[model samples]
Target: MMRSSPFLRGTALAVSLVLSAPAMAGGYAKSPPAQQSNEESRHRTLTNSPSYVPIAALTATVQANHRARGLLQIEAGLEVPDAQLRRRVERYMPRLRNAWVTALSVYAGVNYRYGDIPDADRIAEVLQEATDMTLGEEGAQILIGMIIIHGD
Candidate 1:
């Protein structure tokens, strides 16, 4: 019978320990519980938690981005004929929409936090200018189909 090298034995033991540790610890039992039903769990967590706010805001922003993306897709479908142009437009659409929505959402959320609507509008105007410059006229027009212009 061949003798195993000390180094190999040590490596094998280490690997064994790592592989078996979780099983020995009662794997499933160590895991967290499943979330409760929607209605029952609705008020269980703190509403004002910073961690929760960002997640909720991110979700809402993502939804808004999806809407913007849909609008862009529609516009691209109407405007572009060739497959290559359509594909390129589709690929860029999500990034454009997400950037715009995230900027708008952040501005609005910060303004709401401070109870300052006018300032938020001003900031939004600046954001819009930036977006328009970045996106150009055609891109701006596509985005406009999704977002409502509040003032002018």
Candidate 2:
């Protein structure tokens, strides 16, 4: 049996960690979670708590010219800090999903392209508008997760 050197084992471990680390730009990564500051940890906890309401992945077909091109998908959720507001958001999850679908359809049709990077700000604004319209207030903070386009 061949025993690996300590340096090789350490290097291997580090390479695996680096590969597993999440990319901080343009995509969501879940590495260094423990390194997050206290406030960040609290915020993360809050989002995963009862106050954080999860939304199923919102998807729409990317359309251009006169046919379907690809699928645009985004994962998101609502963070309602107030307990009462959280209850309301939970109750309205279905309505919120519907609104998000409608808004995403519009955005995909007008703003997104099949091969280009997605415009996250515009998408967030669209989702936020839908949220405001459906909830009739601005208590729920929209927490957008991953935004990606699947090419046909």
Candidate 3:
């Protein structure tokens, strides 16, 4: 029988240790790369993207009219008698729809002229306010329904 040299035995052991250590851990380990900055992402998003100006402008206008309608509903509810209020509300339905549509149209035209969409945050704010005004309010339900029916 031949005896193995001590140096060869030690070298074999070292190689086995290195390979076995990784296998024991189950796989290679590494941290993911850090996220890109917001500014960098925004710049990428805006670059070469087609303008949505008309849609944005229309969204703003519709939102504004939505708010106006809510206010008018509340005011009418408080001021007018129930029977008369219903009639008045019915009468104003056409006007309210027209107002919303007109707002959207004007904004769309402006956006077209400018060749860039306006930010929708302002319009969104107004619409949110209008939505808040309608919730839990008595006469607002009918008015909101009317606005939806006429506007749609």
- Whose lDDT is greatest here? 2
Q: Which pairs clash in model 1?
A: none
Q: Sort by lDDT, best first: what order?
A: 2, 1, 3
Record all residue pairs in model 3 with backbone atoms less than 3 Å apart, i.e. clashing.
Answer: 53-117
Q: What's each prediction's TM-score? A: 0.26, 0.66, 0.23
Instruction: Judge candidate 2 against the unseen true structure and give its global Cα lDDT, from 0 to 1.
Output: 0.83
Query: How many backbone clashes can be found in candidate 1?
Result: 0
Summarize candidate 2's per-residue lDDT along 65-95 as a digit string, tens digits.
7889889989887878899878888888889
Q: Please identify which of the two predictions, 1 or 2, would achieve the higher TM-score against the true structure.
A: 2
Clashes of 2: 0
The lDDT of model 3 is: 0.36
What's the lDDT for all of these models?
Answer: 0.41, 0.83, 0.36
The TM-score ranking, best first, is: 2, 1, 3
Q: What root-mean-square deviation over C-alphas does model 3 reach?
A: 19.0
C-alpha RMSD for every candidate: 14.5, 12.7, 19.0
What does candidate 1's lDDT look like per residue over 77-126, in tens digits? 12333455445545566555565556556554444322222343444454
- For candidate 2, list the clashing residue pairs, or say none: none
Tens digits of per-residue lDDT for model 3 on 1-152? Answer: 99999999999999999989977666446333333454334322212323211111112222233332111111111122355544554555555444444543554444322323343543333433442343323342211111111121
For candidate 2, the per-residue lDDT at 19 reads: 79
Model 2 TM-score?
Answer: 0.66
